[model samples]
Target: MMMNHCGLLTERKEAVPLKSIEVQLEVKDHVATVVSTLNYENKEDKPIEAVFVFPLPGDAAVCHFSAQIGQKHIVAEVKDKQQAKEEYDHALSSGQQAFLLEGSEEISDIFSLKVGSLPPGESASIGLEYVTELAVQADDGLRFCLPAVLNPRYQPQGSESPSVQVTSVPASLVPYSLSFSVQVSSPHAISKVESSCSLEPLQYLNTDQTQATVKLAAGHKFDRDIELLIYYKDAHQPTAVVEAGQASAKPGSLMGDPVVMVSLYPEFPQSVMSSHTSCGEFVFLIDRSGSMGCRMNQKRPQETRISSARDTLLLLLKSLPMGCYFNIYSFGSTFEHIFPKSMEYNEMTMEEALRKVEKMKDDLGGTDILQPLQHIYSQPCIPSHPRQLFVFTDGEVGNTKEVIDLVKKNSGSHRCFSFGIGEGASSALINGIAKEGGGHAQFITGTDRMQPKVMQSLKFALQPSVEDISVSWDLPKGVSATILSPPITTLFQGQRSLIYAQLTGKSSETTEGSVTVKFSFEGHPSKNQLHFSLKPAEDSGLTVHRLAARTVICSLELEWKPNGQQNEEIKKKVVELSVQSGVSSFFTAFIAINKDSPESVQGPLRCRIIPTPLYRAYIDSQVRQCSGKIYCPPSGPLIVL
Candidate 1:
């Protein structure tokens, strides 16, 4: 049974400790720094501990966490995950207040925060800051999302463990309030800032129109995620930013060397772009889990995710080149294939697939995508016809890292194009597989027509694959460069590729440096170059350095193995880098202890779980009536107190 007050799921209804959240965003070109402050007050008579699970963008680097308890201030320190957990447990056993924030072991985007030993009527404020690179949309705008919903991830039976335990209620019933504001600055004029939610009018801060401020409209209900599309006048122009190293860090280290972030927008020649390859293999993987029966968004309650996916699949099937090979696969607790093997695209095959797709239902019990993926990858790829795999899902899978690793292992034979079908989809799953599989990722949400985005990706698939990509650097004598990010493997027309590099040694402030990217597309070689000053931008706050560190850490993590001597060394390096850079990783956590408490309270600490808002569609579809009351099904129960 759901409680009326904020729809909390508890044996005994009580006031939620979380009261309000305030967010501040600073955008410099395509990178953003977000600082969120959460205010909490213990209204219970005895001491209590609260646990909250939340979502963050998969690529973000959390750099700061602090807490203010009454008049005492404590700043968290990044430490080894086990050590941090031990410290937090010890503090709690000693009757001292403590806080522990950790990233999910299985999923990168899911995080859990524990606020322990809050005294009765005492108030605390938490501050969390992170920096991330904004993803470029199919259009020229940059996209930034603040995820407020944590949908339950479906765990297959016999899996190791669930990523995170999420307690969710309807969006309209969330208790806390949110205040969000953004300040944007760029090299070019800010054309506009659009959001899926309501927002106040944009306010330009400077006469040049390069600086602006905007805020969310008052009284916004915490429902779907907040998405902002920021547009600039010259969005396609290539640029680079060099950030100085931290002065306190030791030299010759990652944090000590100056880092440069280069943004490249590759433009294919009209002749090459106009021609599309007619010979290739296209495989479409669709999700038919029970949650797919839910509506796509609040505005279109009649349009369910399966329906939209079906319509998009129809368009994709009709658009295939005549000579291409194709197949269709759908997965849930089990999987089905339209054809036993890849077949030539023709009228008969197309019609058969269309008829079967129309009759598909969302009766599958849970999301178990690994088996289907293994089956697809096991098939021998047809020679002379490149394979392109298209995966469409609401992104509810629990084995994200394993799936992404499998894709990376099989990437040589196929390129994967991924589509996230609805709100609260796992960005880590969608983006990770696409990035590892050497293709593109797209998110469809909030009245978005899946046709356009899917069609765009198909166009990318049909384009001639780029090859022989290489990067070169030009710098003054005695100055060298070290590449930090993984090498660029795929390039599309008008798509942006970001490169991060470290500059070692020193050069004059007036010295200049340049980088050139060369690649072969459609049998034609092309190059793009950007030149910039050696001097770092003043007061840049080292955003580039942190982002570069995250890039290197992710690459290192992917190289790690479960039971290898080399993997242990790799894990140690990741921990050291994460600690030195103050960035969150799979092996480290942020821990804070309140040492200056006035007194130790003598009482048993009650445990409370702050429920995040569930998607309205899930509430409608998953809840079942039983014996005059409504309850969620046992197959995938998301409501837990």
Candidate 2:
């Protein structure tokens, strides 16, 4: 079951005031003892007398605690395990100044600490020490949870007074599950088991997942291996699932579109197919112009974009298959390769590549990408494997069409992916080039999440399912199609073939028919056939495998750019269709919004949250994506409505 972080929000009917209550913790470990101290604070000046509850991990058994307020400090220690009950009984007894309550403890079970009156402008702290033999076991991990009561202890005050507010602590920042583990029979068995480990509070900064330090013993490979699939839920709502994919998005979509994807494995079904093994050659066309200096780490410790690209290249070298080949080419006013040509993997080559990547720093001058793409295009030594060309720059080139045309010409043999660095870079031009090259385009938001997508793009480009796939659909009579997951043959190895499209003109009765898909692969038959049944599309849960196959040609044509007048007409149709379908677009929304005079809202009180209908729809989709572990942050913090 998915877990939710819960919160309580209270507002005064008359007075415009709010109160927040929170708890924080610090932990220390010495020898066999684990000491945990919690700090509780009431943000509002009003007195807060609510019970604060915390959870201890299942293994640890509480020994005693230290409590204090002003000059009253009390420490309780039990000489024997049986005598621990006395300490708790004494704490529950109220005192003149303050009182404490203790609960029973069990091996590795969660225990709660309750704090009663934390007055406004006043705070309290308490400490607990526990012992656990599990700490010495192989997986030395720790986790803790704390929950607060909002307005738990309240007198019948006027309704205008502020009530206590509580929020679920940020799970990623909270202390939980420090380690994870999985063990398989063999390296190959790793794929079969597809071990999954969960890490708590994965949302915090400075958190990292690493392979454990322990090594395989002499007789067998490491007894324990761990892979983490962290799921975090915000307390404000139910748990959700958020998916990530690298597909090109419809135009005008928010740059922060949530990617919805799932893991799969077809070949070697025994292996857990969370990730794909990929191979491709990386050709880095770097820009070293003077205007580009601001992009490099110039005087700062942070490496510039060019340096970042090089560093990313080094990381790719380390992560990609050992057989993958790569070449580095840098450009400014001129073009040059760090190596004479593409080189295969080896310790010496990696060292040389790393050194060269580091030295090819910021060289200020005009930016020109054509020269390098042309230079590489001119080379006869291009690797025979699936070729991937990565152009990294600030996107200030003179003639974008020239690059686009050049990319289109060579894309039959290579997929050219472009990266636009910095905020001012040209999105349209980079996107255009990628579309023409039959590759994907991505903007480097920042250096942090760069390598994951970059590597994925290369992998996708290299392992395309079927090249030049063609489709044609003709209904038996009065039939039409509304394309959904359009036909694209860049399918990965382990993922399923999820083809979706909408159909119109069918009766309430089922329709019978077949659709065809044709495509050619290198050294294969001139064409291959894929036939499927045509299902009548409905407004609800319609499966369009047939329509998807029929509309593959239209989806291909979606990439075509028309001449001046024709282009305008096509753009108009795209805008109209996109709006009517409720799909986002790069070209349509502007026309719709500008043509209408939107109604305005003016009042002392306004709806600050998104409409419940839309918010729930989006959240519902997210809940399905992350397998109930992720939660969509509610519109509480957004003022869309």
C-alpha TM-score for every candidate: 0.93, 0.40
Residue 422 C-alpha lDDT in model 1: 73
Superposed model 2: Cα runs more than 4 Å off:
1-281, 290-292, 295-303, 319-325, 381-383, 396-402, 420-432, 440-443, 461-465, 468-479, 482-489, 494-502, 511-641
Worst 10 residues of 1 by lDDT: 625-634
- What would the C-alpha RMSD of candidate 1 be, to one decimal place? 4.0
- lDDT, candidates in the order shown: 0.82, 0.38
- Model 1 gets an lDDT of 0.82
Per-residue lDDT of candidate 2, residues 517-581 (tens digit): 44444423232223333542222110112122213322432444535546666555544443333
What's the distance in Å from true for residue 79, model 2? 85
lDDT of 2: 0.38
